[model samples]
Target: MSTPGEKPDTRELVEADVVPRSRWRMQLVWLVPIVALLVGGWLATKAVLERGEKITISFKTGEGLEAGKTKLKFKDVDIGVVEAVTLSTDRKHVVAKAEVVRDVANLLVDNTRFWVVRPRISGGTVSGLGTLLSGSYIDVDVGNAVKPRTDFVGLEVPPVFASDIPGREFTLKSAGLGSLDVGSPVFFRRLQVGQIASYQLDPDGKGVTLKVFVNAPYDRFVKGDTRFWHASGVDMAFDTNGLRVETQSIVSIIIGGVAFESPADSIEQVAAAANAQFELYATRADAMKQHDRIVDKYVVNFIDSVRGLTVGAPVDFRGVVIGEVTQIYTRFDPEHRRFSIPVEIQIYPERFTSRYQTGRAGGRISDDPKGIANYLVENGFRFQLRSGNPLTGQLYLAMDYFPDAPKAKIDWSRSPPELPAVPRTLQSLQDSVTRLLTKLNNIPFEAIGNDARTTLRTTNSMLSKLDADVIPRAHDTLASAQTALDSANSALQPESSLQQTTEETLRELARTSAALRTLADYLSQHPEALVRGKSGGQP
Candidate 1:
């Protein structure tokens, strides 16, 4: 600096001659930091935007869901986050805006179901408490395979995986539907395999129809011959023993379910229509269908025929239960203009096949002609009334095979086969007692009382006459004979006639006593004389 300013050295003029050239270097140093800040801001913005995909999901309710703080998980891994929440136009549901990771977008599919996962009230499956720390969001169950993007259906409760896929349009008409709730499991062979999808009243409002969905493997087991029944809660029962209902677990008190059992042999044919309807019956309709052709079209009256029967009551052939009474109801028969009770029953004809003899040795009646002749000649089928609960006088049907009985003349038109009458069990015994009392009541009590009185009077009179007349005379006669015997005994006394003989006998006895005493004295004095006298002479 001093050399360049040599011209100014003469005056040492203010040394502020020229600003340093290093000013530009100092400005460059500050500019580098500003450029770096700008690049960093742009990078951060791009990273945030690239992390996820935008998605909108709608829900009926969002009680357990939260926006901004909620996360969406797939296979337990965080895949997305809830960005915003707003109500729909109708204010019926909450619309949730979510940002899912781009990689997981393909997981959304038509079959994918969305529902709120939270703790259950009763002792069942519970979840979503982890959301308290992480947050609450829809759990995405991306199936094992990749799926197409679509709107997923939402469920009020967690959707269960069924073994069989249920038809969307299929419906089940049941007696009681309001009693059942969603998520109630349907059982096949006592194993849970499906659930109730929804329920509603029929268009006529007479009954309810339940929409049920069965899952994969289980649906395969449901064939055309499968039977369904209400397998939930307490089924009402009223009988001679009074009202009785059976209940299982306490949990069943609040929830109900349905069950099905497949027939051992079923038709392999599938329904022609995509959606097929099946009608369930409490009893076998085969026999009834056959009977319908023969019987006149009279209204069926359940009260007249089977009102007395209860659950588990047997519908039998010859004292054996070929079936059982299942349900009973009263309905109007429009043709007859009268009310009638319809009884529903379930029959297992196969149960009676073995009981009927099928061989030449005396087989039961068979539908086959070749077997029919032998059956007619050898055996016959009949139904008999049997007591199930003796104390309650509950009766059931029993079937029996009789080979020795005559063949019954059956009327194909309007004729029910006569049932065999069974001997009294405890229930019949009570009935017998009742009948006996009724018979006794028919007797004329006044006439019986008069006859009894007359008979008693005659007996008393006969006894009195015997005591007063014949008995007294016989006693008098016996007294007279006894007096005569006493007199005869007194006259035959021995003392009067034998007195002299007695005196002579006493004298002899005294002399003999004296001689014996004298002999005893002599022997004591002369023992040697007593011994020699035995050979010599008589003393």
Candidate 2:
């Protein structure tokens, strides 16, 4: 310490040795702080190097999410944690910041999927039950894509399948979603083969496109010609073939599902490529029907009632279905003041060709369909509306030979060439009755009745005269006959007087004969007395 006024010792102090202050000496007090600072810096560097990827996930809502508490998991293994949760600039979504472990940082790719795990039910599935006890976490699905991404959109629902599951995804286009939803099961031959991965409405809003995954060996059965249909609820049909009930399973009945199968006749069993697009039919019958490439349209005009006919009604040729009714409309002829029913039918010519094996190969009908039709019409081929279901009053168009049908000409100039039509059998019978009644109505019934009444009166008068004149004469004749019979009976009696008189006369004659015999004997004795013998004998 230098005194305030003592300057005389300064010359002697530096003369003994010239000493230099150490350039880099750390003070003891600062030693602890330096060491601590070094350690803190090392830790910060290590954290920067060993820390997982920092990612932000956008969610619709902050439901089932928490900052610093919710973990990020892959296959139920903790790989990261949610560090912060904040709202987006537009306030439309909740953005979660997460730190993934360095070990799995490579898995944060553009295709990696993230979703909040929560207890929920969808499409007949109960998932995330463990989350109820353990709290919600961010679920991650690792992606194979090499492109790294930090910003992501979280899914609202769990994925239908895991990335590691061996399967092929397919796209199905349908008129509507029906009962199908994400996670809805997909069936192959009623076997649970896959589930619906996702669905989106078509751009034009005309239909929906669904993505489905068929697992492993079942995926091998997905052929190019495989048909898909909605197998939801019960498929009950009552038709010409009779009642048919079809279903996949009880699960399908409750939550709806999709089913696929190749036609039994199909030979193309090659596995379909991934994401193959296919049409989704409403029912199995529709899906299984053979596609017809050849179509022929015609119009049939009927003068009779088409009460039970409808669109899609079968157009039958004999017992075979050749076509279907497309449309039915009424036409009025102003000049004739008459109405006619015109039915538009779409015929599958290939159906006829294939069934009958006609014309040429490859199911080709005759080159001249018009000429053939005209010839058939000339040969009495006509269309008639016939009842298909009596109870339901459903009608179908029948094409058959009607040799007795009235001759008619086909007007080929119409948009759809007109085909000849005959009245249904019932209608024809009604017409016959109407004509018979008309003929009976023409008879002169009043004149006939008057003539018959006059004849009856004349006959009755004649009969009355006969009865009054003939009855008295007939009774008198009968009485006379009876009297004659009584007189004859009395004459035959033994006690009558005439009978006694006759007996006495006969006795006198007998006495005279005896006297004559005695006189003859005396005459024999005396010849002279012969003449007077009889007198003497008498005397």
lDDT of each: 0.58, 0.89
Residue lDDT tens for model 1, 402-447: 5555555432243222123232244457778999999999999999
**Poorest lDDT segment (10 consecutive residues) of candidate 2:** 530-539
lDDT of 2 at 233: 95
Give the Å error, residue 307, model 2.
2.3
In Å, residue 164's CA in model 2 sits off its true spot by 2.2
Q: Give the TM-score of candidate 2.
A: 0.80
How many steric clashes between backbone atoms does each model show?
A: 22, 1
Q: Could you say which candidate leads in lDDT? A: 2
Q: Which stretches of candidate 2 lie over 4 Å from their true place?
A: 1-38, 354-362, 470-539
Give the C-alpha miss distance for residue 159 in model 2, angstroms.
Answer: 1.6
lDDT score for candidate 1 against the true structure: 0.58
- Candidate 1 lands at a TM-score of 0.52
